[model samples]
Target: MNVHTAARIVPLHENDPRSQDPVLEELVDFVGYRPNALLTMARKPGVVPALLKLLGVTLRGDGLLTEPLRFLVAAEAARGARCRYTTTHLVHAAHHLGIGWDKLAALPSYLDDPRYTGQERKALAIATAGGTLPVREPAQAIGQARQVFTEEEVVEIVSCVAMVGWFNRWNGLMGSVLEPVPSEALAHVPWLKNLEV
Candidate 1:
């Protein structure tokens, strides 16, 4: 699907007095900057905090998935959803975590890449299945994934994909503009050329 050319809703600019919701500060601290999507969602007083809190649980809480693995899951889902904004953010985050550039650049072809562990490939496949529209995750894929990942780890993997699902839809619908940080960070990768927007 093509990215929307215009936002369905108007976004709040950082300098706008109306954008001064206190929760935006929390997001800034979380991400090192106020992403355009979060600032836009800050239009609703409650959403920013609630989303961040959920993100904390999904990303930072005790779980079988490592932070790097979680980032891969998120990126896979974002790419499947064709969401450049979300894809760029997660891929940029992966780079910061010291995951190899070639591994990241090879994400679309994970099945053949030796760099990705079997567990990582399973999670990526699940993420790919989950990210498609009409939301069809194959039973075989989930079952196979379960063999390698614990039931809790499967939940964590699905949770990571599910989280990006929200951002992918939100940013896709919002036509959210990309910020410079992730935009710049994603520049060196070839497969991520879609993120150049």
Candidate 2:
């Protein structure tokens, strides 16, 4: 077995009871495999539904934040929390949303890349701040975000990051394993190398 498999606190298999859950089944269908982070959360089955509901609101609900920006916030939050697992998943998700591969590959240098629009950079900065603990949201960052977005959009961005922040803590504490699907998809991403630690 791989060393990363040691993080499995509960069995999560095709035959596992939770794997049969409609929601879990939907997720499996979407990703082409069961994500190990969700499996860790599956240890307490009740948590899955609640988290999914939260995901529905933050990820799929009507909001001023665009889908791509929300994915960026999620990825940035995962990056801030240092969870390669979640970051990999978010990057895969970004690809599915039709974001350019070059931009995804250049993620490590997002702050310097001319490809990112002014709003994207500001949103990313907010995601970075929201991801960190001690909640270090700088005045300047928030000000920049406010300039680029409305108060409602700013709230949406922060809310999106906060959702990912919870998953970061949950998965990190569980030592959640990185499943093959996401691991394979993100294998070539240069920025992901920095998160191996």
Candidate 3:
């Protein structure tokens, strides 16, 4: 695994609590909670600014899924690809949303795990199979997802996975560092230490 520390860069726009609209504040908090090493790297070259702008538009417009669900989809994609940096970030994102480490770890096993609800199981199966299989296989997974999610929601979920997969590939290829999870969060989620590729 790569051990280089990621250098933090300033956000293009100030994250002042007073200056932010309610929705923007929520988005900022969500981003702040996750250690996105890839975004940090991208910011150094001005890529993050453009990406954030696009994300802002998407979030404000057609992103039909909730923030936590989008994060979950990305987490599944990152885990399946074994991209440590992306996985670590997504894990932290899940933690921020009150998801337990055991639940996060069991994501890969959700299809067969009795603990998952039918909808949760279906989403996980779709995410897992979509990550591991080609686009064609994801058609079946998408069909399953449609049973639980609206067409727009399913598209957002699939888009989240695809975006995470792209970031995971880049992080792996660039040998990005895995930032440690926050100490407070780590204390509550010991299973994170045992996470496997």
Candidate 4:
């Protein structure tokens, strides 16, 4: 189950001063540890701070979507990309927010699952569109999402998906290693079916 790639890049170890940069500390605070993705992104100048800022704005939008629901949307996007890397983080954040492992394991059936509301379903659908791409009907996805969400709210949902899209592509290609806190905390990997890249 070693999912790493042959051309894997090493993340900055905690002892590396670059890993201790103030902006990088924000990621430490957010994830409760220095994330491997952030540590790797830190190798480039200014990417960490700017990306973290984008994360804050996207995840902490104008109070339209609840924080837990935001994590829910992210889970769908992670499934779309078949990224165990990002989904592991979502499970970590979800647990911190009091969302349970049972709920995470049930995500594949969200469309008919009683756990999600119509609005949440729309947002999840839109998120998957972005993550999986060339989504047969782009306009249809946006239209469906707009039905249950305001223009601003739709933008918020899109922001969540787009933000994760970065990680989906970067981590998938870089073969970024998953941190134990989230990766191991996740009880099961049912969101995507044999689709982790």
TM-scores, one per candidate: 0.87, 0.89, 0.69, 0.89
User: What is the lDDT of every predicted structure here?
Assistant: 0.79, 0.75, 0.59, 0.76
**Candidate rank order under lDDT:** 1, 4, 2, 3
Give the C-alpha lDDT of model 4.
0.76
Q: Candidates sorted by TM-score, descending order?
A: 4, 2, 1, 3
- TM-score of model 3 vs. true structure: 0.69
Q: Which ten residues in a row have the lowest lDDT in candidate 3?
A: 10-19
Query: Candidate 2: lDDT of 120?
Result: 92
lDDT per residue (tens digit) for residues 1-197 in model 3: 33445423332334433233444345557656433443344445545554555555433334676666666767777677666556667767776776776776677677777656787666655667666445447777878878888987776666677667656666756655454444343455444344332
- Candidate 2 per-residue lDDT over residues 72-189, each given as its tens digit: 7788778877777778888787776667768877765679999888889988888887778877756777899999799888888888888997777776677777777777545557
- lDDT by residue (53-170, candidate 1, tens digit) is 7776776546677888888888888888887888888888887767877889899999999998898898898888988876775686689899898889999988988888889888
What is the clash count for each candidate, in the order shown? 0, 0, 0, 0
Model 1 TM-score is 0.87
When summed lDDT is taken over every stretch of 10 residues in candidate 4, the lowest stretch is 185-194
